[model samples]
Structures are given as structure tokens and as C-alpha cells.
Target: MSSTQEFIDEAAKIYKVLSNSTRLKILYYLRHQDSETDVKTMVNDLGLVQPIISKQLGILYRYQLVCRHKEGTRVYYVLDDPHVIEMIDDMLKHVKHEIKGEPHPRTLYDNKK
Candidate 1:
């Protein structure tokens, strides 16, 4: 396979991981936090069950999207990449503009004159 195809395949895998709403929520939650958060706190704050949060956290950790540390009996997680949050924020801005029927702000990739 060519390098371009390899890049596309890897990008698709990342999008697949980010496509989960639960994972997105977890990312967003971590983004606003000042420190590492435990699964139990996420379960309580996000109103999700422990297993579901744990599973999603595992996936996020595997993707290198979140970092984790084990202290005592609890495992805490924090956002590993701010770039991921920025991407999500930009997409959300695009979505908001779409919903409001507003023009999209010009990006570096915009080709219009």
C-alpha cells in the first residue's frame, strides 16, 4: 500500500474511535477538568454505569487519547491530547453554523476567493 492509503486507513481508524458519543463525552469531560478524574466520578457526573465508563476509558487509553494512573484501588484519567479536543471543537463550530444557517468561518483549507 502507498503512504497516502496508509494515512487514510489510519485516519479512518481514529475517526471510528472518535465516532462514539460516549467516548466524545469522556473526552469533553476530561477537557474541562483541572486534574485526573476517576471512573467513579465520571459514573456519577456523566450518569453512566461503571462498566460502560471503564470500557470507554480503556478504548480511549488504547487510542492514546487519554492517559491513566492507578492510585490505591482507583484509576484516574486525563486528556492526553489537546489537539483532539481542538478538532472536536472545530467540528462543533461547523455544526453550530450549519444549524444556525450561518456562514462557515474561513479555514486554511478554504479554497474560495
Candidate 2:
């Protein structure tokens, strides 16, 4: 495949990963954390079952969107890229404006004032 197609494919994969609400919740939860978080903590805090959390975490790890480390018998996860967080934050702001029926401020894609 050409380099342009490869880049589009990778970008599509990332969007697919982010398309799930469960995964987005996981990312948002991790964003507020002060340190690496374990599965059990996520289960209790997010009100999700252990199996579901584990499954979603596996996908996040596979995408390299989150990093993990072993602590004793537990595995802890933290965000691997601040750029992903920024992208999510920007999208969220846009969403909020849409929901409020307010005009979104100029963004890179906007050429008109």
C-alpha cells in the first residue's frame, strides 16, 4: 500500500478504537487519575464488571493508547499519549457546543469567521 493509504488505515483503526463508549469512558477515567490504575480500581469506580473492563483494557493496550506495568499481582494502566487526550478534549468541547446549540469557535478546519 502507498504511504498515504497506510496512514489513512492507521487513522481509521484509531477512530474505530475510540468509537466505543466503554473505551471512551475508560480513557476519561484514566485521564482524571493521579497514577496508574489497576483493573479492580476501575471496576469499582466505573461500575463495570471485571471481565468487561479487562477486555476493553486489552484493546487499549493493543492500540498503544495506554501503557501498563506490573505491580505485584496487579497490572496498572496509564495514558501513553497526551495527544490522544487533547484530541478527545477538543472533540468533547465541540460536542458540548453542539448540545448547547452554541456556535463552536474557529478551529483549524474552519476557514470562515
Tell me the tens digit of each residue's lDDT in model 2 across 3-71: 999999999999999999999999999999999999999999999999999999999999999999998
Q: How close is candidate 1 to the true structure, as a TM-score?
A: 0.91
Q: Which regions of candidate 2 deviate over 4 angstroms?
A: 107-113
Give lDDT for model 2.
0.94
- Candidate 1 per-residue lDDT over residues 1-113, each given as its tens digit: 99999999988888999999999999999999999999999999999999999999999899899999999999999999999999999899999999999998777779754
Model 1 steric clash pairs: none
Shift of residue 60 alpha carbon in model 1, Å: 0.7
Return the lDDT, model 2, position 29. Answer: 96
Name the best candidate (by lDDT): 1
**Candidate 1: worst 10 consecutive residues by lDDT?**
104-113
